[model samples]
Target: MKLHALSPLERQDLIKQYAKSFSERAKQHDEEQSFPFENIEELKMIGYTSLSLPKTLGGQGIPLTEWLKLQELIATADGSTSLSIGWHMGIVSELNQKNWPDSVLTHVTKKISQNGFLLNTAATEPDTGSPTRGGKPTTQAKKVGSDWVLSGRKSFTSMVPALDFILVSASMDDDQVGYFLIEKGASGVRVEETWNTIAMRGTASHDLILENVKIPHDHLVELVVPGKKSPSGWLLHIPACYLGIAQAAQTEAVSFASTYSPNSLPGPIKDIPAVQSKIGENEADLIQARYLLYGVSAKWDAATDEERLEMQSELGVAKYHVVNAAQKIVDRAMRVVGAQSLFTSNPLQRYYRDVRAGLHNPPMDDRTLVLLAQSLFN
Candidate 1:
């Protein structure tokens, strides 16, 4: 079916309908640290895998804002699956927005639509940390005749096993930064199973090593001109992922509170005023976070390129409010559930771990606060 032809409400309904099965698949995937092939296949069958492809490419062309909302809904059901697929969706959406050459876009879109292909950004370097700094990439890509040879190591490549292509940021000989599309199974490219983390354990964010991997010139996306500011929307992906985690936390909290009863409590925990109050607080925080995210996203959609560049501080505010508040909301949910929240079988325990990952995401708390202060002061 042509999902792109559907109205916003229809698309939302379609996603909701599929979420039940996806949630079951996610639970299994999370426990085994396995890729959610079943869930992904379901997404492919429903045309969700090709949601971001351009209409010209024979695929649905969903807007990024709509895409983010859909992601939030899916995340509310299963965070690990959502987190895994959301990264791929974001990269695909961004590439579509870039309006690459028709041939390049068509080729990638065909792969995605037909095979449920996935792409991820491999930008995090071990030495320099987050790619937000726009630091000089330790990875180097040099012109070797017709092809560019890329040699570097990238850490925190989320959803490595499922990736079909990776956008690797590298420094050119002229000291310019550029993105190169490195295809899977490319010679000299190896994935190291190094993702040992406390949260998002199912994400498979392993380290990728490239040793003289060759990429065609057309694979290069854009050259990052020196002194140019980074785009604000790029940071939105981090918050988007966290928003999903937060919504999941809220869902689990409400479900548990409504059904679970303690020995001391007369009825379900939901009947307890204190538990109810905690649920209320968590709901309020989630609502606040959602508003901040959608509000900023609306502004972003309406913003011109220049206008968006100037709204760096506002973007930071959105990220800061949503991510930090969502963390607190999840914590409150855990408190409402009491000791049961810590059980391995309880989804709340996973929510706790997943939500904390946002703390380290870009637009770090200190940076956002500093930016806010600078915007208000001098």
Candidate 2:
């Protein structure tokens, strides 16, 4: 079946086919700490990179529900790839709703569809943490005649090895922040090879270093407003990623239980009430988390722009629940496997570490709970 231009069932069928290969390679990617270059090549060759853009932009034109559902499938195969690609997909999805300069949008959209070019933001810095915390970026942008020169370092630049363009957050002379769109070929653009975390090693999330890279004035995508921007359904990718990891855990534990019979047991341990309970718990959490993800994405996709923007708290709550549930499911799966699950060869240990990273992803649990509680008072 063709990967694009399909009904939901066909899309999912194709997704499952690609997911199998991705899963087969995921453990190796983790072990070697290598970027899944083959996986990305296949994804691009199959047109997944442009999957989120509207049909008007020569893309599949799927709604948010469909987009996120497909993303979850990808994540189930390889969480790092899902997350690494999500930065690009989310930017593409958000562009459909924003009023970016038509010339720039036209160029970027064509790059995405024809060249498989991907974009990511280099926003976080060493001096200041996440830009979500409201600190001005340390990256500096100076006007050199009609062009802008950007200089600074950016942390947490996910998929740095694969990105063709980056939305770099930099401070202007006036102290207002501007997001400058820097092409990878810019004179001073470089990747610092700084990402060496215990989780998501396949992401290649290194530091972006800039030293007076020059681009046209229009390269400035937008000026920072320094307050709460509108909530985005596209960010649902983060929750979907962790949830997919949990799904993988569920598959591993269930499979192990079904085949690994011990002398103490009459049959496979899946027959045990304790094993069944753990399986049941994982199943329950997966179902509930899926509801939160797909339901909110569908609602967000179907609503008016204002209605969608108003769903910040609800979306955050949904993300919070899914992340927490995924973490629990992974823990339960590990428990079901006993000490064996901790082995380096087992994927469950990877899932355990990967799922924990979700807690620190955007819309942090503490912030999400505050948003949930603030809505209560309002």
lDDT of each structure?
0.79, 0.87
- What CA RMSD would candidate 2 show? 1.3
Q: Could you say which candidate leads in TM-score?
A: 2
Give the clashing residue pairs of candidate 1, or none: none
For model 1, the stretches where C-alpha displacement exceeds 4 angstroms are 56-59, 96-103, 113-115, 225-229
Model 1 worst lDDT window (10 residues) = 225-234
Candidate 2 colliding pairs, count: 0
Clashing pairs in 2: none
lDDT of 2 at 206: 92
Show the lowest summed lDDT stretch of 10 residues, model 2. Answer: 221-230
Most lDDT-accurate candidate: 2
Provide the global lDDT of candidate 2 against the true structure: 0.87
lDDT of 2 at 275: 97
Scored by lDDT, model 1 comes in at 0.79
